[model samples]
Each structure stands twice: as structure tokens, then as C-alpha cells.
Target: MDLNSSSPQTIPVVSTFSSPFDQSPPVKDPNSASTRKPISLWPGMYHSPVTTALWEARSKIFEGLLDPPKDAPPQSELLTKTPSQSRTTILYNFSSDYILREQYRDPWNEVRIGKLLEDLDALAGTISVKHCSDDDSTTRPLLLVTASVDKIVLKKPISVDIDLKIVGAVIWVGRSSIEIQLDVIQPAKEESDDSEPVALTANFIFVARDSKTGKAAPVNRLSPETELEKFLFEEAEGRSNLRKRKRVGDRKEFENGEVNQLEALLAEGRIFCDMPALADRDSILLKDTCLENSLICQPQQRNIHGRIFGGFLMHRAFELAFSTAYTFAGLVPCFLEVDHVDFLRPVDVGDFLRFKSCVLYTELENPDQPLINVEVAAHVTRPEIRSSEVSNTFYFTFTLRPEAKATRNGFKIRKVVPATEEEARRILDRMDADA
Candidate 1:
């Protein structure tokens, strides 16, 4: 092979380009160093923490529930408050999700109202408050009496549905009165009819983080849903399209009829609603109660140079476990014990950690008790992705007591088989080992 091109006979030498007298290579354009292209940037506005949370709940409910978009709440109910000043702010703060118009409407087709009351039954003890107002001012000292939406008005003209997240709330507070103002985008209708289309308004209820303490208070009801509630179909009997037993008592015709009910039920390949699209009151899927927990830090949680706090991470991990256990057990599931919370390595802030739990085993340890066993896990992504080290794991055991057992009986149970992947198989293996 002539692969030895460097051999003296095959190669040629150029003396002109020799070292000593070699002039420097010509300079390339400094600014035109390389081909230029426009920088790519994600478009549109960025959502604030509040907007993110608001949209999270909104998207969650709408994804798989019947939530109406045209009803409005009554104003009288919107202004209602709890006797306690602490709850007043919480309830008022959570009462709006901006406004949701009809799919093809604007400004006023529906309104959203809310009550965090469903979850508040548990947080009374944790939330510090005092009853200052008289009974005449409002109804009770605890539960909020406000409606989710405060108004609604439908017009002959229609437009697109408007959904905006409510964030950055300012509660105008007095001794007994509080007016909460939330950041929202109010959509306007194109054509203004003399009838004045003004129905769609809405709100959201959430656990407000106390500004001074930075702690989330007990459950508080806010957001008036009267607007949407009024529009929901309360009675579907006569309103449904279920066939009305045509040609009753015709024996000869009945033989040939064979009751085309099945045929009527099966049209156009899609499952038809027997009635107009109806909203279910339970479709607003905000959790009624969340477990008591916080973020913590410790030695094993140290990230870089032992600068990370493990207690802080543990607090968050506990919260994840608590939330999982609470959602599944519902009501007030006790945080009995956090077992073998191994702090393998230091964890620092900014490392994304995931805490999860599922009903591993529910055994009636006693004839009169529902001693449920929850398998909890808290793990962090490899903090130093380059190092491939310092991942943390935390585990726990939670108990569902009788007082709140009734409430959590309906926590969602996932329906899936074991995964076939290596990591998934490891999880399965770990679970089996624990078993």
C-alpha cells in the first residue's frame, strides 16, 4: 500500500512556509467570527407562583370533571365572612379564579365561588385566631360563609372562554371587614347588548401563606360558587333525553319494536349524554384537608461543603409524605412515625426532590381499628449531576385514625401493573424486600 505518503520520495517540502520568517496568519473578522443566528427564546408572559398554583387546580378539575362555565355567584354571599379575623383573610383570599366565560362568550357568562370549608374542619387548632366580631356580623366563628363567584349575566352575543389565574392578592383589612383584591384578567365582550351581558366571574380558595409568619394557616373557605351552582343541573328527570316509553301498551307493535332503547342510546359512535352537559358540585376537586408538615434540614442533607440543611429538606419530604397520606386517607391522617429516614448525603436548595406515598398495606390491626400502613419515599435528584452522588432517601409510616378515617376512605387508588424497566423493577424489588 502507498499509505507511507510521508516517505521522502512521496512527500514534497515547502521552504517558503518555514518557521523563523513565517508571518502571522491573517486575522479573521473578530465580530464575524462565525455564522450568526437569532437567539431562540420562549415567548409569552411568565406565571407567578400564585398564578401557577391557581392554574394547577383549575386545570386539574377541568381535566376530568363537570365544571360549568356560565353561572355567576350571588354578591351577598361573596362578602360574607367568618367570625374569626384570621379566617376572614384566608376565606377572602381564596374566593376567585378570575372569571371563566362560556367557550364562545365573554365578560359575563358564568362566575366561580368557593369555600375552603370542606378542608378547614381540620386546621382550626393550628391556625391561630381570635373571635372578635359579634354573631350579628356573620354566621359562625370557624367555617366561612362566602360563595365562590359573586355574579353572572348571559348575553345574546357570545365569545371565547376566558380563564385567568388569581395571584398576588391584597386583602383590604379592617377590624372586622376585609376586601381581597387578586390579580386577574377580566375579559370583555365584543358586542354590548342593551341587556348587559355580565355573568361570568370566578375565584379560587387556597391555603394562604401568612405574610409575617410564612406559615400556611388552617383551612379557610373562600370563592363563592353560587354563580356556577345555580347553573348546574339539579334535576335531570324530565330534562334528560331518555326516551319516554313511546307507544305504551301496544302489544302488537311491541313485538316488532324490540325496544329501540339500545339503538337510541347508541348514536354517532360517541357516548351521548342523556341530558345537557351538567356540572357536578363535587367536580371542584380541591383537597379538603392537607396533612400537617413542613420542610427541614439535617447533616445527611448537606449538599456542597456541608452547606446544605437536611432538616429543611426533611420538612419538605415530610410534607410530601403527609400530603400523599392525607389525600389517600382523607380526613386527618396522623403523622405517626417517619421510619428509617436515611440521610445518605448532603442535599442543597435548588435540587428537585420528590416525596411520594401509597397505601402499601391496610390491615385492621384491631377489630375496631383501621390501622393502615402507608409506604412513603422521599428522594432527591442527583444534586451534583456531574458527581453522580449525594442523593437522599427518606421513609415513613403513617396511621389513619378513626376520627378522620371516614373522610379519607375514598383516597384515589392507582390501577397499574408493575413496570418492566430497571428502575421500576428496583422499586418493585425494594417493595418486595420490604414485604
Candidate 2:
């Protein structure tokens, strides 16, 4: 379905071949006698040199080995850029028998959502870099780090046999933060004028930091032009305010020991589950349904920014979450959405990272499709300092396919019961956030 088409005031419809921003550069013909090999032909080719330079500069500055360029433009010279100025469209022509397509295909012959997540993160970063740049290649670039993913919803399953387009642009910008909106679209067959069906939508939040001082850096302001642009800008503003208010509310709620009606009801349910005679046999303790994996952060997995790649962390977390759901339900679970992801801290190389996942809750309201909510927490542990910090938290929603459910005859997911107050609080927090 065309979500943007539903509203008259929505952003201008994106065309299949034309866009506000520059189109994808033409693919170089391999047969052409060129002294240089195309980056695509190389396995480990880094696509964006501008982004890589910025990341490397940031790392050097952090380590006190280099200083920010003296010729960097002053804040007064930063120009206000419109969303269209940085709007970008990247196409993945998987319909062709290309080598890259094979890497993104899953065992089911569908696009691997995990790999797509990684590409999305990379694309968002690229857009942010474009928005921050003043069209001057000589000046040093600001370090933009992914602060969090506001939301990512998959409206339709993606097929690997079709070409996919990723369109994104800066929707809003704060003094030191930027919000980017991205849409994953599948071009309509026959190339008609109809809007493409959006398979997914994601909003990513990034924070700008100075390469020299490692301090919050100012970014170009966003100037909304069309009615749709203005509306999206306002919507993003509201979401930002809501996030702030929610954070404050959470802190106060924890400090005051407040218990709402929903929390009280859930607490009662926990109490009931504690009683063997009254407990539901179809329920399982949340703690008892956990799966975990550990790995040392390696340099090879780092991003262009020289730290552990956010997408890599997401890929690992997602695999674990998927496995946890599969093991719990005894059926292959289909990913529904990434409710949200929070990057709490930067994970340095060589840090021992542990990914812990568990089934947070389940919804059996729809008999045909049982939904499972899984949460994965990425912790960076330093045994020498006896410190363990949560670097990232991911929430994924999955559901059983109808065919898989039908094959099981009477498959049912057990309700996840919180065994401790902490677990109960975690569930309540998630529920509250969703609400």
C-alpha cells in the first residue's frame, strides 16, 4: 500500500527513475578497458571515501594523534539546507543475477532483513553526512554517531527477486541532532505512474560531535518548503518532545515508587503465577526463556567511525532474538518489526560483549498468528574493572507464519510470566513505552 498517498498533505511522491537528489551513479562496465577496477568488483571495497575520512579523522582526534583542520569552516558559515538538498535514493538491483544479490538473500530466498538493517544504518549515516556538508570537500567533516532508532516498521515482506529502492532525507534538525526518515520501496511492475508500495519505513536519530573536542557539534538547520515537509518537521518535533517527556517521566516514576493501574494488575498476575495451585500451566517464567551469546568486539566489525558498528551489533542481536523466538515457539518465527533500538554507549574494540535475549511477552489474540516480543541487551563487560555497561538494547517483534502454525495442528505460545520484581518492571516499562 502507498502510505504517503493516503494523506493529501504527505510528502511529494517519489518517482522510480527521477528524484530530488542525485540518482545512483551509473554502474561501470567491467568490459571497458579502465586501469582502475571498480569498487564493486572488489570484495572489501569501502563505498564512501568521504564518510571513511571523517570517521578516521574522528578516531585520530580522539586518540590525540591528530587535530581538527585549521581551515574548517566556522559555525557562521554553516548554511541552512532543505530536505531536498540532501535527499538521496539508493537502488539495489537484486532482480539481476548479480553477486551482491546472493549475499543479501536468505535460505528462504527472501531478502535477509538483518543485512538490510545494516545497510539502512549505513545509508542513514551517509544522508547525515550529506546534510552536514557545505559542499566543500576541503573542510573537515563532523563526526555523526547514531544516537538511536526511533522506530522501524515492516509493512510488507521483501522479496529478493525484485529491485529495492531506499530513499531518505533529513526531516528535522536540532542544534546538535538530526532526524532522518527513510522508506524502503519496491517499484511497481510495468513502470506505471502509481506510487510504489512502501515495504518499510524507518526513522533514525543521529547526534553530531566535534572531531577535535569530542563535544556536541552544531549542524545545518533544516528549512521546510512544501506543506508535507512542514508537517513532517512538526511531527518530528512532537516525537522529540515525547521522547524527552517519556525519559523524565520514567525517572520520576522510578524515584517515586509509583504504580499505575496496569502495573498493579500485572503485579497481581505475577502473584497468581507464584502460586503453584493457581498458576497457569501454559505460562513460562521470563527468566527461564533466555538465550545468550558472547563475543569480543573486533576491529574488522567496526564501522567507518572506527568503533563497533551499530549495524553489526544489530545483526547479532537480531539473530539471537530470532533464535530465542524460534526455540520458544518451536516454529520458524517471521520478523514483524523492530520496535526500537537504543545505542547507549560506544563499544570499543577488544571489549568483551555479551548479547542476552529473552521473550518479553506474547500475544495470542490472533489465533492464526501469535506475536512474540523479544528483547536483546548488548552488554560490554570489562572484567578487569568489574564493569558491565549496556551498550545497546533492541526490541524485535515476530509472529508465526500461518503455514507453520497449521503444520503444528495446535501450536500455542506460552505466556511469559515475570518471576521477579525487576523482570515485572522491565515488562511494564516496555509496555508503557509502547503505549
Using lDDT as the measure, the top candidate is: 2
Per TM-score, the best of the predicted structures is 2
**Candidate 2 Cα lDDT to native:** 0.74
- On residues 89-175, what C-alpha lDDT tens digit does candidate 2 reach at each position? 666656653565676788777788887787678778767877887654345668888999999988877888777777788999998
**Candidate 2 off by > 4 Å:** 1-75, 188-195, 254-278
Model 2 earns a TM-score of 0.81
Query: Each candidate's lDDT (Cα)?
Result: 0.30, 0.74
Clashes of each: 63, 0
**Poorest stretch of ten by lDDT in candidate 1:** 37-46
Predicted structure 1: lDDT: 0.30
Q: In model 2, what is the error at residue 319, expressed in angstroms? A: 0.9
